[model samples]
Target: MSGDGEEDASLEFTPTWIIAIVCTVIIFMSFFFERFLHYIGKVLKRKKNFALFEALLKVQEELMLLGFISLMLSVSQVSLQKTCIKESLMLRGLPCKRESPNSVSHVTFVRHYQTNFPLDFTGMRMLLASESGGSGHCKSMRDWKSWEAKIQQEDDTAEKMVKHVHELQFIKKRFKENKIFSWLHSFGKQFYGTITIDDYRAMRLGFIMMHYKDNPKFNFYKYMIRALETDFKKVVGISWYFWALVIVFLLLNINGWHAYFWISIVPFILLFIVGSKLEHIISNLATKVVDQNAIAIGNCVVIPSDDLFWFKSPKLVLFFIHYILFQNAFDIAYFFWILTTYSFGSCIMGKKAYIIPRLVFSGIIQVVCGYSTLPLYAIVSHMGSRYKKAILPHHMHETFDQWLANAKTNKLKREETSNEGTVDKFWGAWNRKKASNKTEVVAKLEEEMQEVQHEPVPEIEIGIHN
Candidate 1:
């Protein structure tokens, strides 16, 4: 009891322990009483309680970092706990008396992961069966074909699974081809009149040389919008001023603005650097890469638009099925807006709007961006468009065909009415001119040229010399 000294020296409260306790409280509040906290925030905001509102948001941010902090703490403790007992045994990988989470080797962790995740045995087995290249996990997966390992034989269902060893091997083989493997193997047959795994492997060889489909997007504004949507995260972070403001705010909040006012100069320089010509080039580069790889995969072009799902084949049946999913509660943008406004804050400063807050401006921007970003917004907004029978008789291709038809019609009209003439118009003008020349009717052009040539140059006086 005397050796304990009323408790171990490690049990004493420190800054780290205090921080951990605070984080635990915040995480608990965030998880259990999120709505209540928001309500309290709204009430505080309405009453113009600045300090409390700011404090609440600070806690919210702590809640965001809670998971990350917990992970770091666990890892740190595992690597350092043995040092508490003896100085000489301060080795990083020293094991504690109890089975620490760190003691669970990578293989054990992965086994647990494969068993629990996906919540479906078929999916778990399929994922485990994937040939992760040359990793030790591959060896484990290979060993799964053997009789000793029980993972291949175990099932949650009370009904007895196949007891035979060969049956397990067959299931393992079946799990290896989970995705479009059969379909990928069929592509050579569909295109080249050959169906084999060899053909699929051969397709991989031409991966470097494969060409992608490119959209002939003549509309600059529309194309630019699409580009922005594809990589909005990258585009938004281009502003050095935004980063400067963020850094300054953090420094001031952390170390008292007056105490380290000079510390802000560095961020100001960064902001200035961002607005310079060099920063402009970086911004342009980001914009260039925006949607360049949208529909590109390896060297192959998957689809014309980045709006569609990546893995889904661009077939008529699948396209309509995707459309049905779109129609049914695809209000993801609205959800984001609500969370940002209510949970984050109405202002850039994390304060309530009360007046013309940032949320209002952001809402407008979000609506514009979402509509420009995808045709689903338009199709969904237009009620009864889904049920328009004449447009899509079987709904096989669905609103996608309707959208395309409208797009084509608008494109044709733009071509007709645009001030910038097309290739056809240029050729037509050339042909007409040729016909006129052949008919000997070029007098107007000759007279115009002669008039230009014969026109006298006006004499100008220098300063007051005239």
Candidate 2:
């Protein structure tokens, strides 16, 4: 019986090489899948609104990267659990049980058992329950009651911890709701309400470009045009070949032809290299076109040149990096927490098939929520605008003030001219109607109205506005 058990354990254990290969394949598939989606979008001409489509694509790429990272972490944890279990059983001179890496249940088992009852023999017995025992690893059926009771205790403790964390978050929320913070929040809200998210993004991008304006090789307009044009042309030309290769890989994967999957991936690898070369060639051509027609092309797009001084500040750049890092750290932690909780629940419920779908859904929600809150965060934090006046050079500040004053004056002049035109049109229409009857009183009124229209309108000084 012991020999049979050993044989079963050996058969059940997944080889390390297989795990590594599977992980590699998964990562490759994710990359190709994203590329495939972009190709489809291009082929369908869904990129008519280039900026918005590009932003969406960026979010999709980030989500894919996050999922890849999470997968790696989960696999590492599983491998660690497997190693620890095998070592523990070997040291105790016990027969190895059936070990498999098909589920993430070991994460919960290892966390609870290893941390709380490291020296307890029964903890090891319970952990072995995660190994292919179908929830009955103990010697007798009576121990099942004890197992349930212990698990319930652990769940209760976890719930308490979660509740404590929520309380802290509540306190933080209340602090933000205080008078001063609330006032600042409202101010930021108003500022952002005046400028849309897309406009804000464009402003930031323009700032970046202006900061690098001194670099001869970095023309923002040319680079943008090149990227857009290159992607479109490349997608149209190579999409069919890319999809065909992907389909071949999929067929191999589905048919259980594992060895052929690697062979099939070779074609994709070659195609990627060739496509990249083609893209570079196309980009060069597009850049030349942009250079030759710089003025005409530049006129078609609104390039943000104002507030360039604000973005060029080194401190502002550092702060932007800091905020982005902090946001990403929080996002990563939240993603892992969701996965861990989902894994724990799924283990108890004995449903493991939903992990992938849950992961994808969670990623989408995280991306959406992150983007939706980013504008608010930037506004409330007063991220880059707070120190603009203090950090700006004296010359630049003066220049901006002068430009602003001129703009206000021009705007007022235009408004006055428009108002005068309206009066002239109204009087001219009345005079034309009366001229048909040759009324002397109407003719006298027209002369007076023409004199009033000719007089200069008083200029009311416009106040400074944001």
Candidate 3:
């Protein structure tokens, strides 16, 4: 009996080790393939955006994207590898050859899953569950009670994967059924979802795909044209903020800033012209194409009048925000680049240039710009513009119009009565929309609250395991 037991253990151990080694190699190859795909994506995006010259600012952006994608792939690869290792160990230790990878190896569906490498099984399950449900009475069940601390200790991989699958499915199913539920859940999940290395990887491809799907006529040249337009504005914006620092460097120049004055002026003037032209093009394109989508989608509720100048669509507002933010961020980067280049120039010229002053000035400017931008973001967000519009009954519009009039009248009274009171303009719009879809929002809100109640208590806490 003792000899037989030893032989059984030996038989189990050898095959499991072989399988694990093979799987491990496959995982490594998958990671390598992902990296290759990422580089291809980057080259394509850069070409499309026409960030020619592969200039300092554009190069930095490319590097950041690569770093983020690599980090995400690393995290996911680690998680999947760890799970495989754990299963391998279990198979090796146990006397059960039946549980080896070979057991599921023959199953066509399982083989397909292994081949495709889908990141969001939870999403698939949720979509399936929603399709299974009828008349918007969607429901999901999860056995949270079995999720005890001891169970995790005994089966960490199984527990974690199961929990992740359950939570994601729940969110996805709820998203399809309720609008308010979709907004809150989607927004809330973004924090945990995109905040991680793996989450970044998962979303990066989706982002690329989404943009591509939106613009199918997207040739390399068109992409390059758009990219060049975007980048020109960015470079020009940076130049504006760096003008003061440039003057200071000119004063400190031993050969005299005058010697290279024309050279400097040419670049600055060219940047300004390019920036202005790009900004104009982008704005016009947005108003024409982007606003049209907003109108079609019903996202133009707040600004229903033909008063495009006075009341901007949410989509246009967002585009302008991106325009400003991108420009400012580039500007901040340019200041730092100047600081670097000038410091180098000073070193080569044997001038005693203390970079400390430049660093201090740069820090102050960045802080001021960052703080000033917050209000702009808030106003843009509150405008309640979206690319896609919510579909509602015709009666809802009349109801919303009445609510808007009341809210507008109330806002006017407050503004007239007190100098401190300005229009709570965005909320006034929301109040009007709610008046129109009083039934829909209310029903959606109620459904979301119930979902909150039904959600399984989170099994893992960051600081403590529960």
Candidate 4:
């Protein structure tokens, strides 16, 4: 019984299965929830307050973006933590071995007896020292206190260095804000017509909203309508097949197979299938409409409406789907990797301390990764098309140029108005009083001249009549 108890204690918390199950459930729930929202939107469209539907769609998009960012942060945090822990152990000459070197499994710390060591920097140092042949032993409590003080001094120095770096950055920013630099910046913006990735994204979003507004039937309502009209058995069969695939993948994941790769690859296949279907739909619609109405620009055909709808709607949807699915696979793989690289029984900092750093690191990673890749992706995706000659009611380049011209004109007008107001204000009440007196004198002189002319004319008219 004692031996059995010992064995039970030896086994640490391995929550890989839980992570796998939760991720799977989240994926399915998110899909069904989206469908449910679409149904609600359909109902709302019949009401006067259809703005609620638009708000709901915006919220959903924002939430998806937030979720992706969160997932990315989590992956980065875990990866960084794992690296820190491994390096700390190695530095102390401790043995860190995984239970299964080739697969996702828990790590084991060999020749270590302490199970409740703290995860803070000092605690980690002490724990590792103890493990490295009684190096944690000191002559007295005073020695331990001294050692802690030394660590604290080092931490204070590090903090001071960080503060110094921040000061330098602030100084650099102030220097860049000088009049000469500011003028150069404005000049560059005027010359280049400052467009950015965010501008493109905003434009794309506007186009999507316009597309949905123009073609209400081309949305999720169509799918719902089809589902309602289809044979119940066929719908059931399709659903069952989908669920079966999901279950098979989940089982594979549980068995420690390369399920994530399969999951990630499946989205690409679906993207291809969906892309072909969308192309067919678009082609059929094209046949029905006049060629003159649709303008082919680059790789996309823009449909003329109140606003241009870049006709890559299907591709856009497929890209989002693929991105989400790939993210899920990446998250699952990262969790498994982290778990396999670190021993669950090992001491770690309290949740609050651990989480704060992770959050900060995640934010840094998100900003770096987002800015580095997003613009490049946007530019590359929109590059090179054979159909640039199609004349349209409004061209993007012309619109942008007009907007830039208008902005510059408005800025100049504002500056001139401000300068005139400043000059008027500088003269204070003197300028206003002088102007008012001048106007009054002119009015009095005109009145006097008018009276004199009227009196002479009356006498002259009477003599002529006699």
Candidate 5:
């Protein structure tokens, strides 16, 4: 056991630089591409908006893209390694039993998950239920119960109102049903009615195709394009700066520093051009393309306190590592493997394979493994901002600040007008206990008074007879 413990510790501490190298190239290239997007956006907003520097940023963006893609493809040429069971990349898959002298296995999905990954309140159910937390949800059933405790703790009228508001917000954002998942349920309801690692495996584009058989109102292609556009923005928009920081951090643990010197040059140059310029451009573009989604899904009745921002950091961190990293790693691995199963993609499935896998999967692996999680999150911020139109009814929609302010106003009026209900309203157990105690005291006093009122006449008659 001791020997096994030491071995496990050793493996955990061993940094995977190959992952860093791949991610560095993707994000480094993405930074410049996004800068070009920003430039284009700026010119559209107004030509005088940094037109002189546009040529330079464009040239830089182009060069980095070329260099990064070349290097990434080269890395994929490394000696044969085992592919994840979830992935079906031609060079690494089981069908390709023959080992190639030059090929990269990369990290497998199962192996990455074996590492002790973490998540949060929103993500707790999966983690606690994963075989990580013992017998999974079968044992404790803690996920749904955790929220019950939180709700009960909030006793006051105002606090309870806010709690209700936050719950609504949480549902809309965190526990949202996927379009594919919902569509599947609808299809099943139409006929049979039914519902992870093995979930999205065979069905590559999701159950959307099956859904098409039931009802085809939604343009799945348009929906995909929207999702992909958000991903593209994340990989190459103003979000690229976040990607740059991520690249530097990953590169820190890597061995061959000089190989990345040229790569680092452009990100270093990018720092100078960044200011309010890109921010302004992106904001304008967002007003058109993204903010509409935000409006559709904005329902929070409690304005967060300014100090809550600090605490939200940790929550956001857990959310990322859990939902995005863990779930996506498996989902994307499955997606990549399915390419071989696709009608035209069957050529890459079996042995005698000569094809080189694309770095697109490599990029997906890095983010899914929590490498560039923050930056990738920054890029896809808009997608997270919006929800399906049917999610929350318009009447139910209320901003946190709006609801909070209204609650405060009502609370103040009630407090000033009469103090009668304040104790019952705000206090949870203490007020109940107090009311019970008072009732007991009153009943005891009344019993004593009745005894006194009746006892004297009987006693006086007895004394007179004696």
Candidate 6:
């Protein structure tokens, strides 16, 4: 009886059979729990929690992968399951027209899309015919068309309806002509013509906005405040040091305080290099781009005042230099002050009101740099004014009229010169120069130049003609 019982137990539960049973139960439980959660409407709430749960979910994925690897290692047996999947996908191709019955066609023909509007007639007809059998609505539209013809014999309803259809067609034609598709293709090769310097300025601002818009870590205003605080601290500290050095020389009867003077050299050199670099970045990357846009739009030059620069210059060079360097130095000077105070601690190293020469120098640098920006602004304004004049409506009209006059004058001059055997041959030299070269080389050069100059025009046809 014991042997028989052991044999029956072996038959009921082999290792492979136990493993398969466990796998089936585990798979079924996973599917059941997933469906249960979805049925309880927890899936939508879980999806909405993605932003908060992103990090946790990623860690879970990694942990799950590790767990699976460990499980495979521990288990000698492996199993594979296969399933079939089907899905629908939408794809774009050339637009095609669907065929309609004679009655449907007549109703569609009378409802033109150009001028007068019909309320969802096409949409309704299409939906009804597609969903339900077209037997009913199709017959109704046909009967309406015949009835409309008979009504037209005694009333102006038919004529009015026909006019409405014609107007609808006109509207459709106009809309098709001005479609976004046409605009893109038509201006494909005209980038330079449409994009001006003002556009570039706007683009520069856009780039800045895109980079910093949603980033909480980078606050431009806070950075500026830090810069300003750094500058102020340096200014006050340098003032205190200068007076302290004077007092030391008097109290100790020291004839020459060479050590103090020498120590000052290190700070000056460091501040100069750092300040210059900071100034360059600000002026070139930030201020210059903005000013360039303003100049382009207004057509005037802007000049910076002497406040922005350390050196005073003549008007002409100052105009160009100020625009180039004013904002850069102001920005750099701020950063320099911060570095000196935090890194060197030279500004606040001495007694209060001691007048440190280094501090005074920093202040002088800031004042000079700040003042110089004024003149650069003026120069920018001037250039911007000139640009404005060039593109202004009335001014442009005058310029165009003048251009026409100049063209006429040139034509007259050319005609007069032609009679005197003077063709003003521009290509004569090039032709002579190329005459000795290989025909293929000359032809190739000509072909290349032509290709460079050629602008392709888009072909547009209205209605079904194209």
> RMSD to native for every prediction?
30.3, 32.6, 37.1, 31.8, 25.4, 39.6
Clashes, model 4: 0
Tell me, by TM-score, which candidate is best: 2
What tens digits encode model 3's per-residue C-alpha lDDT throughout 1-466? 2355546545354577677898999899878856874675577556543232233244345445545655675577636444443444533321112424655643332333233332222222222222212121111001111222222244313332223221332122322334454345433332221122222112222222344445322232222233333333333232333435444443333332332323333333333332332222222322333333322321111121222222544344434433333333333343344445444443222323433443343343333223322222222222222311112222454588789999999998887866443346667787888897998888899999999999999787568568
Against the true structure, whose lDDT is highest? 2
lDDT of each: 0.33, 0.37, 0.36, 0.37, 0.34, 0.34
- lDDT score, candidate 4: 0.37
**Candidate 4 TM-score to native:** 0.22
Clashes of each: 0, 0, 7, 0, 7, 67
Error of 5 at 361 (Å): 17
Ranking by lDDT: 2, 4, 3, 6, 5, 1
> Per-residue CA lDDT of candidate 5, range 171-229, in tens?
23222135455333322222110101111111111222233334323333233323323
The segments of candidate 5 whose C-alpha lies over 4 angstroms from its true place after superposition are 1-39, 42-66, 71-303, 306-311, 314-466
- Measured with C-alpha atoms, the lDDT of residue 216 in candidate 2 is 23
**Model 1: per-residue Cα lDDT over 1-466, one tens digit each:** 1355435434453357676998999898766777886887999678754434554565455444544645665566445433335423322222112246567665454343233211212221112112111132223223322322332243424454334321332122222232355334322222221112221212212221222113221122222223222222222111345335434433342211221223323322332222222212212222322334333222121112222222322222223322222211112222243354444442211223222332343333233223221222211111110212222222334467788899999998897776456766888999999998876656877778899999998999778655
lDDT of 2 at 150: 40
Stretches off by above 4 angstroms in model 4 are 1-277, 289-322, 325-332, 335-414, 417-430, 433-466
Cα lDDT, model 2, residue 149: 41
Whole-model lDDT, model 2: 0.37
**Each candidate's TM vs. the true structure?**
0.18, 0.23, 0.19, 0.22, 0.20, 0.16
User: For residue 34, what is the lDDT in candidate 5?
Assistant: 73
Estimate, for each residue in 1-466, the C-alpha lDDT of model 6 and write its tens digit.
2356546555355567676898999899878954664543454345543222332333234334435644663352222112222211111110112244343543233222111111112222222112222132233234334433443344322332222211332122212233354334223312112222332223222322444335322322222223322222222121234335434422332223333333434434433433332232223232343334422321111223333333422233333322223222322333343344444343312322322564564454333333322212222222211111212233355688999999999999998988665444656656766775767798899999999789687799778765
Off by over 4 Å in 3: 1-320, 341-466
Q: Candidate 2 regions off by >4 Å?
A: 1-40, 43-47, 51-64, 82-109, 112-311, 314-466
**Distance from true position, residue 3, model 2, in Å?**
22
